[model samples]
Target chain A: METNDKINQMNDDELNKIHSDSLGLNVPENYFFESKNRILNKVVTKEEPKTIPFYRKKTIWFAAATLTLFLGLTVCNKYAALDEQKIADQLTDSIAQIDNENGATAVSKNNFNNQIPNISLTAENDILVSSLFVEEKEVDQYITNCILEDM
Target chain B: MANESDFIDQLISETHRDNAFKKLLDLYQVRLYWHIRKLVITHENADDVLQNTFIRVYKSLANFSQQSSLYTWMYKIAYNESIRFLEQNKNKHSISIEDVNTKYLNCLLEDTFFEGDAMQLKLQTAVSELNYKQRQIFNMKYYDDLKFREIATILEMKEGTIKTLYYNAVKFIENNIEILPVKKGESVQNTENI
Candidate 1:
């Protein structure tokens, strides 16, 4: 009997009967049961019929985009407010320093107003009006007058 | 047991799907586990593949339209899952399929779940030496006790091809297994003729 012939003779039944003893492997107890639960958990997670794909939910993405834009605009507005406040603080401090230096002479409000013409204090851009109108020669003359008045 | 179509319907039916699938698991889990274990060659690997197989079966149950028997479809899935698992490992490690199969068989020796004696180890080595597809075909035919026609359906190959491979696989095993003797009339064929 050739090898092939002999093998053909040992068909499914004979082969199984002979090899079952050797190959009958074992697994941990309750492995299948616990593993089934695990599989079921995965199945439940996968089979959500009501849930839509992330890309398809355009409204949610749009809402997110709008919210992000709104937050960005608000942050920019806050920065602008802080910058304007910084300008106002610097302007107020400068004005206080000048007032302190000239406190002794006590320049009249109308005279000081006339000297620094159109000294507008506005909240829009927190600008100071010191050099808006005064020419260099006129500013030198005003400084001399103030110094003379102080003396 | 329900008839084939009834069983498939039960497996697909939402009301009866769980119960039917549980029965399917109970009926086929041990056999399928062992079948996958033989191909994959470790209890742990077998467990993973077997779970994947059943989950696939459950998911594809609705799409099953009785084109083939449920057994054939499930077996096909089990075989595919095992192949997928091995292919994944092979690709991840950049190894040939033969090298992966050898590694799996070598794993059997040190695997705690494997309680095979020396002869059993020899059997495993002999079976492992067969070509990969033949090894699976042989195991399906021999251990799983599946008919060649059913094996063909599961493997999605020609029944004749499965039969030829199985016989050749058996011959190869007979030659390799040390304890399996070439009896009085059985002679080893020449390499050229074989």
Candidate 2:
């Protein structure tokens, strides 16, 4: 009765015809046969968040670039900074040997001071200065020499 | 249909639930497919929304509560799911509603499942032009043949408001739908009281 009352609103035959034969969308053959599993599959997998492809995700691309730069910095720090003290000590020892071979102490020390303007370690014989490692002013001088060499 | 409360009871039960759900799908899927088809305007889209609707219905079984008829509750889900699909598609493709409607019409024309003639196409076009809420009112009232009270319940609108919206939608369709044909003696113009 409600359906009839609603249909009665279109009184004219042309209007009625249009209303009666609204849309003629064809249903596909066997369409229903496969849809059950298809829908069930989606429901089963719905709990897992659908992953946006890495290439498509802007965040993923940004993260990959950030990780690469971070790793490069880490490798540079490990290889470069850890070896600095050993390299500095070995260079000091080699220079002392060269000075001793020349049979000159004060003259060799003066020449060494001139060569490395940044390194300032006081010594009567250069050996005492070379043997030192982290007595405030000496460590500062070592750091300055390393920085100058790096620059 | 009167035994629907029993059906719901069985659906909520663990033992009879799976069989009852399969039965529910078999009964409602075809009806829902056509209902969604009229709104979404494509076989592929309707098929997708139908699946989604059933999936939602299955998940939301605990909430059924028999507040409305089973089909009506399911119908509400189908309605919401279809609209959500349309909105998502519109945003995903970066198209205006007008552009989206045009694309749907084009799809309707090309789809193998669309066997409508010119007038049918014109009716669909007119429906597409109505305000979205008005289209919802119109489809529920006209095609689905649902009562104003039921539609009001589904849409959560007042009955009077739904009546006004439906009338307004009918008038809108009347104005927008061309290809109004008449018999040999009848006049081209229509005269009537609202």
Candidate 3:
């Protein structure tokens, strides 16, 4: 029985025949091949920058312009700040000069008012000499005190 | 070293002089797609991953080493890329063993991308029973017809380990098929054929 079974065993040709007996299945004729070819061609095709969307191109240009403007403004702001500081300094000097003139005029008027009795009683010649000498001395003393206080 | 230099020269010259890259795309795209499809188990995801793989290959062609065959290196890249895609999408769906096996089987049955021969179907069934690494080794070796050494380079495994995996996978398929029940005349005919 084992010898008969051994004789009955099929060979490679018989197996090939069995496989061949089945229906031959070909790839369906459909859109897949054409679509795949289209995809492949699209992938391999060289695309230029112009082919990109307008919005994206515009965004790139906008970004570049914005950066350039920002840098230019930053440089301009630095120079502008320096010029503003110079103008501010000149205005501050003018204000200091006005303050000095007002202070001196107030001191002189106070001295003149305090010598009222001598100005009313005396004739013009006598009052003028005394007033002039006293005022000169007072003004000298006032100027010395003002200089010391300032220092 | 000389062989490596020669291969690099060939690749560089091919890049410069000919459209050999289109031939490469035709040869590798389907195989790589199927390999990635098995891992990802979704046609759309597989398609995207396959395109990304080719794009990366095109970008990094200048830095490619010639120590291995171009296919081996490409397979390695594709395998890693598939794993990375899986990792990135791991949160989208929780993958289970049963889910993986069922999806893999269904993809093989439904995918129009491959040549659906009877032997290919049988091979797919055989592969479905294997563990993940075993399935990978079997597919690379049997379906892709890659050498064990090339597979080792692709999978970064020892050659001996890949050999053992292939052997075990084949044995498992054969044993599983042998134990299936049969009718009397059918059994007699099947035994006779064997």
Top candidate on DockQ is 2
Residues A94-142, candidate 2: write the lDDT tens digits: 7888779987675454565456533322222245433433478877898
Highest TM-score against the true fold, candidate: 1
| Docking outcome class, model 3 | incorrect
Tens-place lDDT digits, model 1, residues B1-194: 33667777777788787777766765666667777878787778888898888888888888886787777777888888988998898899898878977685678776667777777778788877887788888778656668888988887799889878877877787778755433224443421132
Docking class of 2: incorrect
Q: Can you give the lDDT of residue A116 in candidate 1?
A: 53
Any residue pairs clashing in model 1, and if so which? A1-B185, A1-B186
Q: B1-194, model 2: which lDDT tens digit per residue? A: 44778888878887777667766766666667766876787888898899989999988998887878888899989989988888898899897666776576787788876777788888778877777778778777665657888889888899899988888887777788764333334432331121
lDDT of 1 by residue, A1-151 (tens): 2453344435423443444465645567676678767766665334446867898988999999888866775575568767766765566566657877878446544455455523222432232233534688988998999999999
Model 1 residue runs over 4 Å out of place are: A1-20, A44-151, B178-194
Please rank every candidate by TM-score, starting with the best: 1, 2, 3
- The TM-score obtained by model 3 is 0.51
Q: Could you tell me which residue pairs clash in candidate 3?
A: none
Candidate 3 interface RMS: 14.3
Q: Which stretches of candidate 3 lie over 4 Å from their true place?
A: A1-151, B1-18, B37-45, B96-102, B106-123, B178-194
